[model samples]
Target: MGQTVNLKQRLAYNYLRDGSTKFLCYGGAGGGGKSWLGCEWLMQCCYFLPGTRWFAGRNNLKDSRASISVTFGKVAQWHGFTGYRLTNDGIEFDNGSEIIFLDLTYYPVKDPLYERFGSLEFTGGWIEEGGQVNGLAFSVLQTRIGRHLNDKYGIPGKILITCNPKKNWLYDLFYKPWKEGTLEDGYAFVQALVQDNPFATEDYIETLRNTNDKVTKERLYFGNWEYDDDPAVLCDYDAICDLFTNEHVKPSGVSSGSADLAMKGRDRFVAGHWKGNVCYIKLDQGYSTGKSIETDLKRMMIECSIPRSMMIADSDGLGNYLESYLNGIKEFHGGKQPINPEFDNLKSECGFKLAELINNRQIRVVCTDAQRERIKKELSVLKQDHIDADTRRKGIISKEKMKEILGFSPDYLDMLIMAMYFRIKPVPKRPKAKLGDI
Candidate 1:
């Protein structure tokens, strides 16, 4: 006999079978029978829709081949499905339907770049561990759907993602919007905890319940959205997430801001808008260039109504060009004397003060949860050391060292430091304009 269908899976498949929704996200926690559902859905689709093509995979090919592919074959056999053979591509049905198993990862791009998918076409596909994939990858995959072997198939191409609770793009793209009742018309999110699944093992459920980490317990068992694990995290997760509610409503006056041009690998150009104390990030994601970022920064200033003079950007050769364009920007160099004597330089001082704001609960950041995670990760990984010669001085980790820890530069957090830099550092008064000529 085939695997039993749970109520949650039944409802989710009904939505997928209707052909009304383009995207279906099912299951929020582990042991929700999600993988079983994936196997059943793909089999049914291939059997019903003749000559259609589909893809299924996770982040690792070895894992997908060793497990996902094997599971599908077993489930198909149990259902009395016949005349299908498994290959490297997928299981090919006699009707010409195929499910291509794959493994997608970031490889070279800091974020997974879907360049491999540029030429491939498909009817629809399922992502096993959806939380592990980035949003841009999904965007790329969506475009390729609805293009192949779908002409005869009455069902419009649909993408299904089975994943546990994660605070990445999935949260903002599906979970958060679903919670707020703002999910788009053609998309659906199905919430499923372990208890909701009929197939969950008693021991497995017990393990999840007994997890020592609060974040792991909330996520793997209950599918909670607000939890993370990071060492030395300056900003509290609750403190940052709470700013979204209507509890704190300050006037929309932006006092100062920051700009981070693409410096090295994995770093995107960013423009941060600071209102009171919260920082809103705007980035140049698609196009990466000096001129492009120059335009993005100027646009942010006008949009936020921040005076051009109050913003600071790193003083590189490109930054000098941007300085000429804005005419109202500060050139930041970390070598400048710190506002605090204990810190070695401007960058270290800025980092110290930013941490103070976060640890003290004095700052609220207006950023997407995913962006907030990036910032939090960077801050938490940064280690502070004490200098030997100067007993009062506190030394910040070098960029080279931080890169070793994080595998990339902390571009966003750097921009945030610049955003908060102006607040604590005293601006020297303009030199006395005693005119020798006037």
Candidate 2:
């Protein structure tokens, strides 16, 4: 679909052409010619240096065949790689240079999945949908960078990535530092929103406009760095912020809460401690391992005063490791039986119950504006489902769905739910009088 490269594409090409940097991460929004930049850069390298080798792929092999194949095929004729063998798996250039298409799905998230990359080497590579690949995978890929091609041609090993504005490992690795003006040397990031692409059609622009959700609007069209908003938001973000403003409310004497734990990568080890109606977030960070989170929990217990007994930590997924290590902490299984009839499971009950608390002005979150805003963003994307069965069935959106929507797990919101549900009181009954009434 692209006959000519745009301005942002030219900028990335210049960086690669000049050999000004070893890494170039391009494109922020869709239709900004990011994938094109990756392919073009590969073509330029192959043209200049004979027998050059490269690897190009996305997280899903099937998607690679469907989308990237067409993008590469369109330019293969112009670049004289026309004798290539194109398939669902890879493309082989006629010049003895190879572009191996790796389905990174070969490496899953848990355990030592990315270690498989140690078996292969490449001169350079490009990761499409860079958000899907984890940091560990990227780190391993970095080792394979300088191994595949010759240096006599003056083409240094390069790694290019293309992705939308998603808050994932990419955000932490590239965007955050870039935003802070402290992005390390030898790396560059070029952000191209939809407005930057003059080639964007009015019809496509209208489609992005129809998405009324704030995060979706900011991301797909405006390409702003913000949370992804689903159709069903558990709580009103404005209402949650308002709770912090009411000065008449006092902290209750009892102190309790719950936690959502992650050993490392993707999820965070988060805990929210409740003092009366307010929840204070003591742990909401990432880039850790099983051993580190346990240590952090123990340290936070002493420093932040988090009551160990009252906090119920998530017991599913990696949280199992956290539960076993954190002494005296309660375990919360989201799939367990729900206390309310309207909910399909304990997780659903927790979400709806937290919504009730927020709606009634019965809860508050004591934190910095940034913390509150982050919590609100996570809360706003919590979706719900109503199964159309003969008997009504209500369920909270699975963490997997939330992950797809936000590009990562909702750690803080899960902690918030667990903590508030811990404070839910059981119903009471009046004492019965003896037979003296007779």
Candidate 3:
């Protein structure tokens, strides 16, 4: 007997089956049969596309076994497909097609570039709980697929992601763009809520309805993307997203540039040229040596007519190497005292100023989709540190903490924040009155 799927799952299958669509996001809420659809799709493909390889990935292997693997078992039994058996790592079929299970957790120190999967070759894959995976991991996974038996089978390589509402990369890469009708070609998003799933348990539905957590209810029950609210958040998500479309931020003022050169550990070198508040990214690539960045940056400045007197680069780590060559360029040290006494340090002051400029729609960024997504991911982590402690000086969260949360260095946001150095004015001190004058 053939397995049955709801209309929403069927719609996702349509995208998966299409030759044009390469990436697909199936669901946005619980009980939408996301796992079932993903498992069944991979299973059927394993049988149909003989000699092909596939992967089923999640945040961890244990979660994949407990959730996605269990769902695969049920889906297999329901269809009465007995041609496959579970192995130590994954499922292997009689036709030689295999479905490998993978742990897609983001560990910066161990596998910042996800090079562990560098040699992997797969025809397609599914990422369950896609929101839990980091953007860089997903990006690397995309490259690994479409390398196994695709030409032999006459099928396009596809990667399906199943997720609930989350304000991570999925939101920036899918939901927001889908809402704006600007999602790129070859990518598709199909949102399905609990109500759309007919097989959902009544008890589970009732539990979701009865939950007291407003954010959880809104996310799981209604699939709302805008329900999240955190006190420490310095800028609104919408405002951060609007930075790319702020056409009113005219480019009429001083021409300047900012660069954040990576010292090491999988961080990239990022540089941007600016005309007043409008930023135009010139370079964003992995660092091999300071020579390449220095050459590229000098070219950009010369091309943009930006002088070394107006250019700024962080004087930390490898940035010093770039600065040593480009003499007369302004240097920005994050640990130095802030021009504004209210901020804890130079970095904190600029971070807050960047957030203000974003929220006030005073900044505009011109870049490609990949760059835009990276910028959004970086700035989304800009939040106040010690928001509740009145005794502490006002400061944004530290780079180490941001790295922990983002799974990588926030080079883009750091460069953008460093650009605020030009915007900050030194606060004047009041002079003491003379006795005779008084």
Candidate 4:
């Protein structure tokens, strides 16, 4: 019976007062006293609820030790809850309501841990850094709350989740759902920013305001999902398309070719030719026979007058088929030589890199406004969806769903990514004239 805490403390106290809240989520920007409030609330719960059991979850084991266990230890000691043992892994209170600290990141997959967690007869639970835990893991933890509520306790169990919004699936599962009003019945979402806490220092407020990047600033200071508004076109699309108006194009030098071959029926085959930083895109209308593709590629190379060595093809899926075919062909001036080509996975390695190049103005696109709009539409529709039993069992969301949700085909984007991956090099320069020639 240390000095009674305030309303913030009572929120936790009331939750455990009878152990009835099904889910309580407290989240927002940093330095809003989320952790301190959570620790205090949890202590109140343990103190009032005689035999109730609770758990504290962290994103990882190390984080559990540094953040939850250590913070709760201080709060427990301050309140005169004497008979407790603090170990590297968890904290156990003498009253039988222990906060077993564990990390959700022990397994990237979720299902294997459900059996282990299901065995626990927990009254309730808390997730610190809720943003980092996968949505699937959170669902599994929710199932474990059953142990506390029964004919005897007659009180419904609950979970307390606290986190700062950051990149991850949590934003989709928790924050987005809260915004959309789609969270399950009996769940409550309370948002708190630095301004909400009188304890936050002025200097901290100033630092948050000074962050220049809009995304970082919005997330940390304003707690909004601010999309980047920078223009998608690297070069003025109108200006670049104007350059290609003259049908008789002269080669400044050998051009490089990059292809993104479509293997999935829904995707498209896209190829681009780059001379210096300028790129010309060609959208494949249909999947042609292997021989037809080889012929088309050879014809394009001959027309562009680009040597085989300078060409690079995407080596994923059907692209690999094309690469193998071209490797065996013997039609170039270099005497039966295969095109020295490169390959890349468009999603993981190529896409973001290309986005960076566009943002940096190191790459140029034709910038067809209609095409750009279509691509944007597709990207906007991308969503997390369940794919299979493996994903459903593990609580994992599918990345492929994002692509499908995007309405327009991502073939062109894929091609551009592959092209950018292959074309990355030190900016080419002409050899200097003899020193005396100027």
Clashes of each: 0, 0, 0, 1
As a TM-score, model 2 comes out at 0.69
Q: Which candidate number maximizes TM-score?
A: 2
**Residue-level lDDT for 415 in candidate 4:** 57
- Provide the overall lDDT of each model, using Cα atoms, as 2-decimal numbers: 0.75, 0.71, 0.87, 0.58
lDDT of 3: 0.87
By descending TM-score, how would the candidates be arranged? 2, 1, 3, 4
Per-residue alpha-carbon lDDT of candidate 3 for residues 128-193, written as tens digits (9 for 90 to 100): 998788878779988988899898878888999999887777887899899999999989999999
Q: Please give the lDDT score at residue 354 for candidate 4.
A: 50
171 in model 3: Cα distance from truth in Å?
2.5
Residue-level error in angstroms, candidate 4, position 77: 5.5
User: Which residue pairs clash within candidate 2?
Assistant: none
Stretches off by above 4 angstroms in model 4 are 1-21, 77-89, 108-118, 148-151, 210-216, 225-353, 357-416, 419-426, 429-438
For lDDT, candidate 1 versus 2, the one ahead is: 1
Clashes of 3: 0
TM-score of each candidate structure, all chains considered together: 0.65, 0.69, 0.63, 0.58
Model 3: how far is 128 from its true place, Å?
Answer: 1.1
Residue-level lDDT tens digits of model 4 in 137-206: 6778878875874445676777778877653445554566778789766666666777776767999988
Residue-level lDDT of model 2, residues 332-359, one tens digit each, is 8778887666678887888887887786
CA lDDT for candidate 4: 0.58
